[model samples]
Target: MALGLFWATVSLVVFLLISTADMLGYLKPKNHFDVDGKTVVVTGGSQGMGRALGKLLAQRGANVVIVARDRQKLEAALKYISAAAKDVEKQRFHYISADVTKSEENIRIVEEVTSWNNGNSPDVVWANAGGAYSELFIDTPVELMRSQMDLNYFAAAYLAHATLRSWLRPASTKQTSEAAAAVAPRHFIITSSVVCFVGLAGYSPYAPAKSALRSLADSLRSEVRLYNGYRRANPSKGPAADVEIHCVTPGTIFSPGLDNENKTKPAVTHILEESDPRQTEDEAATAAIKGLERGGYLITTQWLGSLLRAGMLGGVPRNAVFMDTMKAWLTPVIWLFMQPDLEGKVLRWGEKNEVKLPQ
Candidate 1:
């Protein structure tokens, strides 16, 4: 009798979950990004979204700077941005060659760009330099995981620290009394991976690194707000200020890396295959700019974007409740429970939030 009763309750709960998902339109698609007239810098701008974003920003009348470890790639990116810029004569196009993983190199890049801008720092900095290679946890080497974290998370933190001062500085002192105007000079954009949301067997290294970044963004957002509050209290010497920080998560776009993976990985291996033809570089950039301009907290492609938002905002309601109920309601059958890894198939990335600019 008890066994039949348990089955009845389980079936009822499952039915409710399915019904909820359908009613909420969980599978619907949408686009949410916006960027316009912002002075922007992109790390790892040689190729992929970094290069794509640079061109889009330039076309929108932004002063765009391309930074990468390869001088040739940086030069090439600059050429592309210059060609795409709306008003080539009015826009400022610049490039810097630096390896962001090295702290000193990042510091030098910040200094160089600041000096070149007549000491005024970039308004938006996009830290898009990251790469992930899939490997099993037991097979993964320790150093590889460290390198991933260093490049994806630490490097971004380092660059933000180096540029924070100039980035948050107040408007020009040389301007006439009437011309003096406040400026929100600092805005940071980070390219974090969708792997941050779900876990899989072979995603040990990459997932953790990406997850760490989400935490970093959350912490940084709080710190910036606290600092802004402090400035408001002691306003005598400080300049007017605001800083905005945005973390952009994108779905799999067809890049060289993804292309290579598609060829190597078996087609039947995963339920969610790489996106068809992936988003073109130009398309992804255009989408991203749209997200920034709209001030999106989580910028994403339509399909996967909705899934992530749902997950963050009270996902797994049925599963959470079911497990708890099982433990209490079915204590005798507790041994039958197994932690099932239903890795989410939706591929989405990006989170955006406001932060204070440095003074």
Candidate 2:
């Protein structure tokens, strides 16, 4: 008992030291850019969280451009975003109607936006267009699975690739050196879901697609770092466009998409996923933007989402906070001990309910 007490005390002291250091900003990464007056592009900006982000960014003085497939929705979003602009004359909001799932369409949209900004590339691109449908993997058609992947995974990938390519263009282009000097750090944000980390029974089709997005975000983060490093080393040629990639893993959000998803979602899946408190679209957007401002690689809106992010760990980099990392490492052990109870809940739910396929 004495030996155990001694070890506990040592552990507590070590944790305190790490936590204090992290809180003192010794472990945090530098924020390379600010959003003020920057050109920001958001996909799926027709409604929900995308619309919220567009409005918020516009209000903060960003020249916001929103893209969506529905022209009417896009126009409506533009009006909402325009109303939120701090300076109507200086901060312009544009809306483009295009299907993000098509690679060619995404490329075209990026090119047009660049042209509209007078050859200036967007400083931030938020890939927020994705949908989810909860159904058993076996009951889901291949077409549905393919559609989900196309929308959730490939859309973000195509947008990121196109935007990065434009941002990394030769510095001798139309952008003046003065503009380059004031350039905000380029950012690519992908809207991945908490489902990416925790796969429930009915979300098999949707979860894998979100998981693919997480993988894409991870790869893009590493690649962007390397690209920025090379540009920095060869500064004589042009300015370095440092791009930061972030993945947002939001828990349940109160949005139109969620409402539609819940219609088809299974009861057992709801029991598992709906355990966390749901966030409004505006609240989620606010949290996501705050995370980006803090230069976080993995952003979560809720405590449950953050805990899941840390617990899953996988190949993603650790959060800048030392206490957060410690919590993440310890969560898996807690999860192991709680597995029986969790499984029992699922078993009981399964026994009481039946999942029916659509006719």
**Residue 322 displacement (Å), model 1:** 27
lDDT of each: 0.64, 0.83
Q: Write the per-residue lDDT of candidate 1 for residues 1-359, one digit (tens) a residue.
A: 99999999999988678556644756333422223455678897888888888887877778888888888877887898789988877778889988898888778877887777777666677888877666655555789878978887888878877766655454454333223224443677777766676565456767787777766666676667765664455444344455666666666776765664444332222434343224777777776676666455445544454344335523212212332343334432321331131223322211232322334
What is candidate 2's lDDT per residue for 1-359, written digit by digit as tens?
Answer: 99999999998898888799777867665654367788999999999999999998987889999999999989998998899888988887798999999999999989999899997778889999998988778788899999988998899999988888887765654444455545557888999999887767788889988998998888888888776676565554544466789999888889999899888777777776555789999999988887886778889988778877888777777666575777777888878865676678788986787745567
Residue-level error in angstroms, candidate 1, position 214: 1.1
What's model 1's lDDT at 114? 73
Pairs in clash, predicted candidate 2: none
For model 1 the TM-score comes to 0.72
Candidate 2, TM-score vs. the true structure? 0.89
Model 2 poorest ten-residue lDDT run: 173-182
Residue 282, candidate 1: how far off, in angstroms? 2.5
lDDT of 2 at 76: 90
Work out the TM-score per prediction: 0.72, 0.89
